[model samples]
Target: MQEQANLNRRNFIRISALTGGGLVLGFNYFLTSCSTSQDGGQVIELNAFVKIDTKGRVTIMSPNPEVGQGVKTSLPMLVAEELDVDWKEIKIEQAGLDTVNYKRQVAGGSGSVRESWESFRKVGATARQMLISAAAAAWGVPAAECATENGHVVYKGKKKTYGELVEQAAKLPVPENVAVKPATAFRIIGQRTRNVDNHAIVTGQYKYGIDTKREGMLYATIIRPPAFGMTLESLDDAEAKRSPGVQQVLRFDNKIAVLGRSTWEVMQAAKKVKPQWKEDGTLESTADYTEKLHGILAKKPEDKPRRQDGNIGQAFAKAAKVIELAFDAPFLAHNTMEPMNFFAHVTADGAELYGPIQTPERARGRIAELLKLPEEKISVMMTRMGGGFGRRLMTDFVEEAAMVSRLAGNVPVNVIWSREDDMTGGFYRPMCSYRYKAALNGNNELVAWHHHSAGVSGGGASPDSFPAGAVPNFQVDAHTYKSPVTTAPWRGPTHNYIAFSEQSFLDEIARQAGKDPVALRLELLEQARANPVGKVNYEPDRFAAVIKKAAEIGGWGKSKGENIFQGFAAHFSFASYVAQVAEVEKQADGKLKLKKIYCVVDCGTVVNPSGAETQVEGSIIDGIGHAMYAELTLTNGRPDQSNFHNYRMIRMREAPAVEIHFIQSSVAPTGLGEPCLPPAGAALANAVFAASGVRLLDQPFIKSGLFA
Candidate 1:
């Protein structure tokens, strides 16, 4: 009943109006339909952020968090590109929950630009049509003769900026078929533009999730069980209550929440408030976990088959030469710059939640589940994310805020997770291991390939993705192990591991067969492109293009003298293809120093060059961290490394000088968030082998002596 009611209300609010200059265009977000009359302003959805006021001012409501991924600028660029409005007149606002129109507001997987591109343009095209019709009516000319430029509509010798005709446009009929500019005619896209939020970032006025402040809002800190699956047994809060500014210490069924005047007070009180826990089971060491994973893989196939090819056992037996290698990636934490935080005001009628989150709609449902309230009564306000990576997707922090508010007798509560708590308590990227093998015939031709992967079990659900290559036989399998710690997508998810093993193994094959790695890949790509196999997931030509481009840019066939070494790798994800080459030099002490990195990508159309470059550079920096130093270790179910000091990220001095080049194409824009991450691992590892003759099969390359 509640769901139905909520759905009904959503439908009722789905169509609204935006009013300006006698215009009456319906002003729902992209999904909502708006109509305009010949004379005045149109009503629009309350959640609609991008609306043209009668004054012809462009207002953009950002639905996703902006943690430096340039969503604030790129997303609005899409809308403005179609709207034909003057960019200077645009005003930006962070959007509130009006799930009636927003879709895929969650920003992760580099899906922001790709997913929102079409919808944003639709919104702008609709608005532009309405403004043009109004101007045509006022000038007594055919609407087709009236063209819009710089917020103005001109027909013959007559001209009127949208602002001058908005009153008339408000009354003009909304055109049913709004015309969108073709790529050839694009004026706003494929152009380098500065980040829309740069001013806010420079001035330190950007409102991150942590910057949210409300009158009489009390701060909170949660104390979770130290060990996974543990139940709270007891609490000692007397000392915490005595701490300065500590207002209350509330104990719930599974945890304790400290409420206080300031974040520091909450943090100080949380430290003093000791909580006892009863272990749910015995702890397992990392080695034990590894053994367990192998055992699971060796056992029977339980779920549906992910992928299968010609009989693997028969193919292996027929081969004269077979090679096998194992690879592993340690658990990773998203470690978003801003710790988890949510401010919730729960009252009798409904609830209001404000903070940093990727998916406001998903957060609303999660809040409803935790608070046991109707979804309609809940409104989530998504603010700028300080850095999501993948950490902000989890709603544990939001749930904690609601729990604190519920316990506080309906008073509003702001739950703040200290950096330590967030690092230790949030979901982690699952650790994974891969066992790969390939069989070669007597003629030294590759015949079969197989990959068996195990770990926290996120990948094997779908066999590793590959193009229809020249290989005759292939098989992919997955093994799962139940983990105490919750897991979520970190960067590229499974592709991060698969790319390292597959690409590195391919390199090995090329070396053994006396063929150039790039040449071999190109040969297989030709087969795939000529007669593609069943259910292949990637484009053969695009994949080969990136490889070829990277090779040329890196001077692959050429060599430098003793000190410098080069390696290459390529990967496709988020509907895009990227290839990279790494140049490394060895220090006298046998330490590896990455000198220059070259990358080429074919991600369809470019949205914003500045935004695209930022994401690519950031992805490279992040990948370097994962390859060289980032890892979260567990000791008795508790994370051993809790802060940046212990679990290191790449510092400025360590970042290799990088060159990024894009393929000029007319394909639709694909995801740019994570495409560059996977190849960095293999490229760096391959470079390590070139520099020091070591093929590190595991991650945190430093631990494997790849760096030293």
Candidate 2:
């Protein structure tokens, strides 16, 4: 019923004439439609974000930024599906930040499609209605008798192309209460469609933010503080200013910008400037931060409980068996393939920003405040991004470009971050640790759950996320330790680090009870289904489906060849459920090799199978790679791992093969960007234990003595 309400929500569409001749339709974020006449001293021109020409060329303006999540292709599929037009007849174009016509333009939180699903559907359906009415009126037939197929209005034995009647459609009254095609009737959707940008991407013609080129633009890079808790006290740019390609050396709050004719030249010139740094606060190392987190978990009465259900203490006292475990994870970097970059041309007239940003509207708002300009004066154009696992959600790079351009008398400039600058710049996935305890009765049935976590910031899930609702007695407490370091959202921020801890700890309970890990999970899930304890967030059947599918695909609990070890994990997030079965081969010398991972996702409808498979593959690679070899440590408040060489990304030779399966359903679509990632670490760690009997309690599994 809720999905129907979302699908049937009414929206206003205004139709007007195109510049030459043809039809154009646009929509407002508001519930009611306004006139085609001018309002608020600006002409919206019928609010037309979609324009169709006399030649049957349909063009759509995709409002969200593309961060390689395939929104550029997937979002358009929604529009084309309802527009009832031949897929080849329509063209997709990226839209700039337009607050008047678009809403929720950010790309983080795996929400591009989940949030915009209804709006895109309405946009296309409204346009389709307008065209059909025009064709019906021309043929002198009742509009009810006419239906659209392949961009044409058909009746009995006659048909008319939409292009032939689009002009007349622009003059008709705007349609009300538009109805969209049902999922079963979809043509363009549920098809194996490749990304529209695939050709350009493969051919190297896609213009990423780092590839931005403007007329007379200066290539700029910045020199940041050496570490956290430090600030630039003084700088002498006498030598740097003398460089042949150096255009200017400017300083802003805590950063120095060196602008030159080219990227390579500015990077080299910036190093020549000498500067003295001063400690603004106490300098701490990785060990200090780790110890602080441990102290919080050990004892912190002042911290309030995040959640509580029943009496965990009483349940533990009555338990015949108890399993306790501690898990730790380190800070991580985004390491986007393309270094952080943005181009800003801030002139007295207005500010123009062009770059790859997950949140273009956010960047525009920040630039407006920085330049002291009206919101309407700023225009932001989004380019394709090489990679942004939540890093691009920060507008710091965009702000620097605007500030640099403003400092240099409104000269156009492109700002780029060096690889080292990106890693040590301080927005890390905060270091954290988890302590879990489960109480089991004499019957070996689970009864209680206790979780205490402490981190530099709140990056993990609260107690209410999962098993909390299944356990009769549960307690959760969270604490934070303040530091000079900054933290922001990483991929699947809450679940990314905690899933490993949560799921692996469940396995520890399974070991203590002498039950199969998958059996224990299914039993608990059945308990939750029969009688949930608290606020339950997921559909039990849907969640269980993925687990069963993945296990079946990986042949869980079946006899295996010698040296083969398998592990299983499942998690739910972002309105999606995922399960993975990871396999590893144990060698004679006591080393383990990752062989393959079987993954299954229930994210409702899969918009594009190709894109969905790619997202799962990428997420698994990212999750396993980070768990196996990635870590960031600090010495004197400065990151010791500066780049890939030291950061230790997963190499091609070490990456495991992934097989994916998605549950086909008629339910409304959800997101795929981050759901499949959270469970990867747990499945891999459990497999490691099965192969080498090494329980990995720490991240960068290699550091946990898995290799030794």
TM-score of each: 0.94, 0.95
Candidate 2 residue spans exceeding 4 A from truth: 1-20, 28-48, 705-708
Query: What lDDT would candidate 1 get against the real structure?
Result: 0.76
Question: Best TM-score goes to which candidate?
Answer: 2
- Give, for candidate 2, the lowest lDDT window spanning 10 residues: 34-43
Q: Judged by lDDT, which candidate is best?
A: 2
Candidate 1 regions with alpha-carbon error over 4 angstroms? 1-30, 35-45, 297-304, 460-464, 467-470, 706-708
lDDT of 1 by residue, 613-666 (tens): 988978887887788888888777778888998988888888998899999988
Let me know the TM-score candidate 1 reaches against the reference structure.
Answer: 0.94
Which ten-residue region of model 1 has the weakest summed lDDT? 1-10
